[model samples]
Target: MEVMQKCCVLFKPDTESKEMSGDSLLEVQRAKRAANLRESLFQILSGLYGIMIVILGAVIPITEIFMSEEIDSTFEGFYIYLYSVSILFLVYVYAYLLRRNRLKTELLTRTLSRSLSSSRAWAKGLARPDTDTKSKFRKRMISLDVSNHHTGTFYLRLGVLGFGIGSMIHSGLNFGSFVSVSGGDCSEPVQWVKPLIHLMFTFFQLYFIFMNSKMCIHRYKKLARFGLVHMCSTNICVWFRSIVVETLHVIHHSDTRGHHGAESGHHPASDNSTHARSYPHSAVGHGISHHGSPGPEYVIHDEGMEKTLVDNMSHVHHISRKLLAASVNASGNISSASKDNCHWKNMMSQAVEEAGPYLYPCTIEYSLMCAGILYIMWTNVGKRPRRPTRSELETDSEDDGVEDEQRAQRMSVDCTSSSRGLFLGILLMVGTIISIIAFYMLVNQEEMQDSAIFLTHMSGTFIYTVTLLALLLAAARMKNLSFHNQQEANLEDILILISYTGLLVFIIFSLIASILAETSTMSTLTILSNVSMLLQATVQTIFMLAGDRMFAATEKQVRKKPGREFITFLLISNFAMWAINTFQTQTPQHNPIQVDFYGPEAWAIFTHISVPLGIYYRFHSTVCFSNIWKNAWKKRKHA
Candidate 1:
């Protein structure tokens, strides 16, 4: 077993220098675990801070109104401004660190993956019949495992606990004095409410701080064990010395130095004259060549020189390894059998030269982004989509070996059948227009003007009637067959169209009521109508971006780029509208005229709820648009 172990170690050259003993190997493992722990803590802290900042920003106006009595106007404004600015600064710092770490981690992963391929090839040529050799042959091994197993679970647990604790604590504080509350007024209740709000803030903030500090200390302890300082060193001496030298250097440097540097780089006028007088053949194969292009002989000479240098390097590497092996064998541990294995020795040496260091806390950016996208889809769409049936799976499994031929056939079939029924397309067009109109009326009009009111209802009904007629004509055209050979609408498309039509019909009715009604009750209904419109638009936009697999199958398709750009632009515009509307709601000009005992008023509630959803939707849309732009740029470059 000892002889086998020695032979195995001899064959695996990459591990020898970095990990010479069991103790050092254990120490490396400890450092890796510590790094991973720090990374995980960092992500969790970042997420928590982001969530808190967003929540605080959304509720600050309402919170201020609630605390009007205790907080003086000047201090309140400054307080809100200061906190908002601080939060924003922290978010910016986190983002910078995230980007830097992401790049570093990706570079490390790429290098490690490349080295893994080389290492596996080296392991394959060992030519040993022992169990250790067979173990290495059975599977390719990497220098490092690119997984952070407990990281996700840690984040999940922390999130659940934090939210649960926060909710419970808030409820406990509020439940005791629930009935006496009258919307941020009354002296006795106001006193407790102010303290209660402050207490809740303090509790949550302190909890976050404690958790963050604990993690930081733990990280530092682990790092100390490995004698590794933080990547951004905070050493006072280093900073002091750097500042002193930089200050002196800046003072000492003169404008003449740059002029002198440029002068030295430029050739003299005499040299230029000399060169101008020389013939092209004057320095042929010698000194400074007068010709702009190298001759065939010169090119051949350069190639020969490069080949000789490479050969010498290889020879030197081989000789050094042989000498090292001889010294190791003289210690009487390395066997004669290992000495005879020249092929394995050479392979191991090459692997050692190429092998990358172990990488811990691998890049989880792609995985996390994919998970976020999945979660958004799952939440919005609701429930897992049905899996493919056995027959469908089997049909897809059948491969006739030529994928291009199969794809062409599929494309032809899609082209032939991909047309939407005329009725459905017309219905969708009218519904989209009506929904947009209704959303505009609800958002823009506090009190409906007669001209706008008359126009809104008239426009909706007229368009719907015209769209129906257009659909009938389109259906007639489809019956002629030749005009509609391209892609027709599928059942899913028809269902989406029908749903949109139904929503538009409801919105049209709500618009009529919103115009006719005198009471404030209809304000709630108006808000609901606007919500429905936004949701419909959001769902359709998401489907348009992600629905068709074929659209994304070839990003280089010229036709697809314009469609993607249009969708991205549309989503961004809609996001902007939501953002602006949400901001407008917070201003004095847009504040609700009537505040009921239940809440800050229907309009206020709508804005507050929409703001958070809008922020999340805007972020998602921004990510989508960024991806679309990147894809378009890539396609354009290739074209």
Candidate 2:
């Protein structure tokens, strides 16, 4: 009887080992299949990236040169080319997304049918010995575990991007109207098409992103990778194009301002003599000459008209000699200008040009937002979902329960705890706004320009210094808090580090220029601002690193956390800095010291490239700080 019991136990051990071996074999097969898919996906992605780089490398410079050469001769055809290509790319992506969604629906329907059939078979007891294995294999083939993890960018950022796209559409329509009415060499069909297509693309693309920004693609992995990567590359190209166009516009404006200044300086007496006489004729001539080639037959030889043209030569110098002659003739017939009326066209052109500076930043920001979202999507393609362990599942449920309890209790923000920081932040914001207003108002005046630039640097220096000190104090207070390191770095952390490099580049360049240039008020201010920004960025990064590791403290220990107020203050301050950088600092006039030191072309390129990233850092930092503030004081769960 004892031998018989022993034999039964030995048989039980053998059966258990067999079952474990089968499961291990299945897992190994699944891993091998995933590895194979990953290898193929990578190869395809590398090929796509290589192709895009080659195409952009060959196309951008050629298009730029063509546009530069044609600028004086004709209205911009570059915009037409740009919008047409963007429209094509957007249309392709739109189609793919729709088709992919449809296919996924069909696949899901088929999977449900199979699952139902198998359930019925089991209910009837018609299932075979291997039925479970076959069903599991089929499920793996038909469905994937999908994850929708937060990518750190908040909906507020998306709102900002939408605002920017709307601004761009408005600007584009104004530009299209100006071109269409001016009756220049710009094609009639193309004039309206650019803005209309831009409007359509933005509407659809924004909708798609809002819907699917967090979706991780698990099926059709190859096609998903290609489409996502294409979208990312296209957005990056758009960003690059925006920066180039903005830089060129700034340089052109500076040249115009410099020429106007030179003329005003050299002939202060002539301005009084011809102020009234030349005003009307020059305005008429500018309107006519800006549109198209006015024929020589339109020239009239009136003495007053000729004098008006000569007095305003600096403004009309870019116009061809034929156009100059035509403008002289048009000025004589200014009273009878009904035949070639341009009043409406002139007003629209002026409005469009005036709005460009404000609207350009929006488009730049939009491109960057799209690029970041698309890049995240690209990385998420084919990402396998991780299965949580039993312990993790329990922890998550407990946390959710805690959150529900807090919500039921009607928990509210602890404003009293952060009152000092909030008040100080408000004051700093008010002072920064005042400085920005003063700088903008005085920047164009020749005598006040230097002082305006100095004021800008000084205000920036003060903000950076204050923020740096606050961050340091917060770090010191939080140094002893209990926390744990993340097992792996996430995409948000990687992106923040990458964005910080952009600001670092700008700071290093500024420091080098300041050190190299002769000592002056502006240079001294630059050095101070650069040092403060560098230190602020470093300390802020450390704070973010520390914040991520921090475990929520108990209510009793919450008072010791100490950085919530500082975090609130830093958030508002960073936002204030973002606004200042976007609207004021990016302008070439505001950075005369860098322009003078690096020369116009080099400086323009440097700022256009780095400033956008710096702006993004400030904007992104606000989001990060807001997250820290929200999570820093949550109640810790005790084991």
Candidate 3:
């Protein structure tokens, strides 16, 4: 009797399963609910801390930009308080994500323990003559189960830590820079405080990296026997996590292949061992796997396993989204209320409003990334294989099975019209051309150092264009597509939509900022760019949550509508700014602004970051707008 644990579910061959006692069933239910509640708490805490960090981060940049050059006593006090808040927020966010990961690890451990116990109990029943085989089987199976512990939790947690640490380091440096200027104007104690803060940040970054690397090495060594790290990924996540987290590997030594017709919803192509172990090709996020296992002739497969996993993960994901929504509202309201309050309250509110947009892109991106991770966890973690279809079984393609490879190559497109793809392609080409022209103008500046700003923008535009083209190609191949496909409207769709919208907002600001830079001083452009970013963030959020569905009234009113008011605004803004730049001349004596908002270095940093982001935004938006244009064109053509 071969007993195996597959995808976190224990399976026994040819033995009638005994029903669990009422007490055991009740205990299991209680445990499940308890685990779910714990997950919810973790998600809520993570979201709350994330919101706090974004709010604080936004304020820092704005404050730096507006900080008075005069060495007033109150100015130092305010700066110190702002930095202190940012540091605290950063620490909280990191701590929360770390705790969340720990919980996930605990859950995975518990599941593995149950699976091992079941496998062990079955092994104990084997005859004395087969003791050697039984012992070997038990060890291999246990090791394989342990290797499955490389859940996406590690990546998610690491990302959270990186964001927090990076923010801390940035804030520390900015605070140090601000205080260093205060010198004799401020007390000697304040000067020493800056050095201490700087040292702590530097030390924390170094120690954190070392400890994380050490842990990854340890995990690699521990799981080496199972061939876990054989084909490591180059993904940023895998690169930094090193070998600790890897894709699922088939345990060939287990000698149990009876996974055919396992669950009703499981795709038949998944039964192919090669497909099961390869990178996700079904429009799912990239995950690696290994295939070395051989299976039995029995048709019985573990059922209800996928449902169990989904039920749990869905609860956690839902909780996370809810937490985020609540946090967004609370943040907005707090900022609103702070407007008429005390000086500190006004400062906090001002930061929330001004910094909200600048810092918001990070929080929004993280949320979407988290959603993607959840989907990957749902599809790959604790997921059993299905029986291969006849065609799949007969195929000679050994590279992760023909069906999966084809699906992987096909690309996932929710739109079915060729016209849509054409329009999208055209939009991308136009945006590409515009970006190139803008790049040319910026590159022609007399100062070579300013080229960094141009190069950054150009690189982003180029990458954005490429992604747009890829998306256009993906959309062109669809057949009989509908936007409201129940399956298509899942969590993945929401994440993709939010991400594209966010990118579009960034691109808009980038183009505006670039256009303005041609005519304005670095300080003026920086201040206005930040303002535009904040506005974009505010509008995009409202549109996605409230206005997106309103567009469903007429397919023509879709969220991606091209030739909309926004495009008009973009065209006018670009044209007006460039025209001003073309006709105007700047002399060193001509200081045009009543306010100098940012340092020269700030301009450089903003350009470096915004240019790449702008490119991605323009590319993504072009494709989306093309789809909208196609929709409108199709309606007009039919009419």
Candidate 4:
């Protein structure tokens, strides 16, 4: 019998005559009122925060373009719509918190600590002693992906709890919203945005410190598995904390699928075409819910159903969507055209090829980047007690040779980037410091309105865009579809031109936005530090895209390699900024007097672009997988 000491669970084969009964599991899985109380406090604060984010996200745009007459101060009127959205989101969040807490307390086990029924195992009646440990080929074909830890789940949950709350309030009249740069009535942070942001950010700050903070008890060499590191300050600690939280998020997602059938009043959608309004496909904001061992399964029989999941995933470009479809198809619940699609097969191969190692670096870099997020004045969690190894932290820009492939094919991996990122960042600083000079040199210096300035903006934006394209081109030259795919007989190449143009635009637009914002010349950059902001907006997106593909590739079958799609999203969103231009100030103003007053308005909607929809998504995520969540919780509780 398997005795899981750490898990605190015992193993037994039959549940029919067990020490713990199924009723006990239900009791273990029941939600608790005490936890509901905790959730209530969180909701009151986060609800307010959600209201604020709704303002920032929703109101600002409306005020900018439609209600331009009320703009006398900062974060003005941003609360009107923000409050509304916050109320709605806060309600949902609080309810969810209540449900989840209940689940935590009452979780139970179905059978034992070990011995899963094998899908492909032969009749056990005549079985002899088995010595071979070789994993079956079919197992590889059916298993869902559990790699990459639970970064997305943990991070998003924390983010939803933290930024979801803070951003909401920041958008509202909350204290987290703004300051009086000009000392005007509205310039001081609004009262509305205050409580929410404070409560959420307080939690954020606390967790940011606790997780990343290390007390140096001992230091081991690079490969030492166990030891301690000490953190005494908050400098660069936000980044450390945020990244650690994010990493744990990934672990949580991978550990168990999110709770399936999570809905207040909705039932799981039967087909792939329609989506749940609450959870959507996966969790909101790319919260993935995986089934089986691998991500998406390639059911080889049906065509229409297979395409349904694939197309949905294609539309979103998220890892979990595709994984879900694959899982469903593999389980024979959907069509099988997916397995027949040549391009889809090729994409799966290429994704595996590139992503296998790319994920390591992304995790490393993302954690290191967290330093900027912990912008509080208290502690420095990222501080190294001793030298961390390249393997331990692929975060350092200096580290190379992370993998031992050493083969010529592998040796030529050109992950080498411009290395000019720092220098270019410096240029942005110089321009910002001497922005007055920059303003003076302009034809409409006093007005801050120049058509030529727009041209320069467009041109500079173009150059940055062109450079992004160049890298993509080099990457394409480096590799191609490797699975020797069989192109679908019915497949016709879509508008290749549109696809390429759309992709290039995404990479460039965000790249430049970030570059222009980092004029702050402080040793400690704010969490929204100019460079860090730029990285978050542009570099982080790129990393997430890469991370998704790398993570998805571990499965037996894949739909499309997502590297190219990542490039496309960048281009499209960049092009989308034109919508903001509709309200660019015509008169001279130091900065555009853009403001909003409400939540759930247009801008608020825009901020929620990446937020997923569907009851399934709210409950079932790619990680913290919903399918196993019930059992895992039950097992833990009954243990």
Report the CA-based lDDT of candidate 4 relative to the real structure.
0.27
Give model 4's TM-score versus the native structure. 0.26
Task: Report backbone clashes per prediction.
Answer: 8, 1, 9, 118
- Model 1 per-residue lDDT at 612: 29
**Lowest-scoring 10 consecutive residues by lDDT in candidate 2?**
327-336
**Candidate achieving higher lDDT, 1 or 2:** 2
Cα lDDT tens digits for candidate 4, 1-639 = 244653344333454446467767666666565555654554355334434443444333323232223333333333323223324433432344223332222111111111122211211311331444223312221111111121222323332343233322222222212221223222333432433443343344334323322221111111111001111111122222222222222322332233322333234444544332232322121222211111222233355665675566334323222222221010111112222221223333343323322122222222222222222111111122333332222211112223334423322322112223324434443433343335336635545444334433443344335435533552453243222133221100111122223333332332333333324321112112223323323432332223222222221212232243323333332322221121111111212111011111221222121111111121112122211111111111000
Stretches of model 3 off by over 4 angstroms after superposition: 1-496, 502-614, 618-639
Model 2 pairs in collision: 300-329
Best by lDDT: 2
Which regions in candidate 2 have their CA more than 4 angstroms from the true location?
1-63, 66-150, 155-167, 170-179, 255-344, 387-405, 408-410, 553-555, 558-561, 635-639
lDDT of 2 by residue, 1-639 (tens): 999999999999899999999999999999999988886868476557736753773365335433332343232354444445545644754565445344344323322333434333432332242678556534331222222333433433454455557545554644454344544333345435545655565565565565456555654666666666665665555566556555644544555564566568842334434343222222122212211222122343466886767646543333322121111110111111121333335454455556655565556666667766667767766664454333222222212223444644423335766777888898998998999899989987889988898888889988998999999888776666667564355445665676688889888877877776667777788899889889988888778766855655555546444777788899889978987887787786876556555656567778877877777778778867765675565544332
lDDT of 3 by residue, 1-639 (tens): 233445224533322243445567889999999976865564455445434544544453333323343322222343344335434433542464333334334333433333434333332332132768656543331111222222222323344344334334333432333233322222245533643453353344333322221121111122221111111110112111111100000111010122222344443445433222222221111111111122222232334554455466444333322221112111121221111221223343344444322332332233233334333332232222232233222121112122554544522222332334345445644554565455456555656424534343343334333443343332342212233222123332354355445445434544443344334544344344444444543443333222211212344433333323332223223332222222211111111121111222222233223322332232223333332322222212100
Candidate topping TM-score = 2
| TM-score for each of the candidates | 0.29, 0.68, 0.29, 0.26
Off by over 4 Å in 1: 1-20, 38-448, 457-539, 545-600, 611-639
- lDDT comparing candidate 1 with the true structure: 0.32
